[model samples]
Target: MLHKFQQFYPDLERLINFIAISDEYVAKAPSQERFLEVIIRLEREVFGTAKMRGPRVASLRVGEPKNLRDCYDTYKAQKRETVEQVTLELETTVRTLVTDVS
Candidate 1:
């Protein structure tokens, strides 16, 4: 399963691109969540499955957007020129996520 990442894309390349090119507030993301997200993307796209590391590697394939590369590239481009807008958007997003909308 790990080999899938090797087949799909280079880790260094993806990390470099994600950190250098991503426009999202991914750097501000909670550490564990960020790690999970990165691992999930790498596993699903490259290995065709995702799983936790263990004595037995149980992986399952999940659907991924064909435009993943595009999405990633766009996300990288999402930087706000103004800090105020960036702060407000982050606050709003957090609020929405926390709000109960049943």
Candidate 2:
């Protein structure tokens, strides 16, 4: 799959190679910032300059919190009620009895 991608986007060969090796050493997916960095670099390479004058195809901030704490808090609040509901279901399941021995 990656070989075919490299063949198609020949200009990204070096970036793809770097990412493959980095993945081996990092053992984790790249962060959003890293993804944006790659996109910006590719845009600059293809356009011959870092064009920041018009609307962009990609952006670093897409309405997401600047830090993990804010994002976590937002999601935690949204999921709190769901978590309570799941806990009640689990407790009920645990207390139920199965009479059929077969």
Candidate 3:
């Protein structure tokens, strides 16, 4: 799964490493609640949000405004921005994880 992801998104190595290390921590957590708490905190610290919540843009309606018809394009642009931001944050988060692990 990871190899496939890397093949498609070569710049995501750091984010993937963060997820891998986080998975290990989550597996070793004492309870599901504890794991959730840790993950939520880590996400808040790294991404500045408790959870990455919501679609990049809200759903469009059948009779949406003319400008709103470009919802798909808006979503794509927002998704790209979010990906860039997450990649930047994950680079620092992964470095922190590596230091802690060492």
Per-candidate TM-score against the hidden true structure: 0.28, 0.25, 0.24
Number of the top TM-score candidate: 1
Q: Score each candidate by Cα lDDT.
A: 0.56, 0.52, 0.57
Instruction: Please rank every candidate by TM-score, starting with the best.
Output: 1, 2, 3
When sorted by lDDT, best at the front, the candidate numbers are: 3, 1, 2
Instruction: State each model's C-alpha RMSD to the native.
Output: 15.5, 18.2, 16.5
lDDT of 3 by residue, 1-102 (tens): 888866865346445645555555666657756655666666655765576554434232232123434455655779777566655666766676666656
For model 1, the stretches where C-alpha displacement exceeds 4 angstroms are 1-25, 54-102
- For model 2, the stretches where C-alpha displacement exceeds 4 angstroms are 1-27, 53-102
The candidate 3 region of ten consecutive residues with least summed lDDT is 57-66
Tens digits of per-residue lDDT, candidate 2, 1-102, equal 888876877557555644544433433566655655555556665765455545445322222223435446555777776556655765554444222211
Q: Which pairs clash inside model 1?
A: 22-76, 23-75, 23-76
Per-residue error for 34 in candidate 3, Å, reads 0.2
- Cα lDDT tens digits, model 1, 1-102, are 998767766556556545653425357665656656666666765765677764444344333224434345445666443445555666676566556341
Whole-model lDDT for model 3 versus the true structure? 0.57
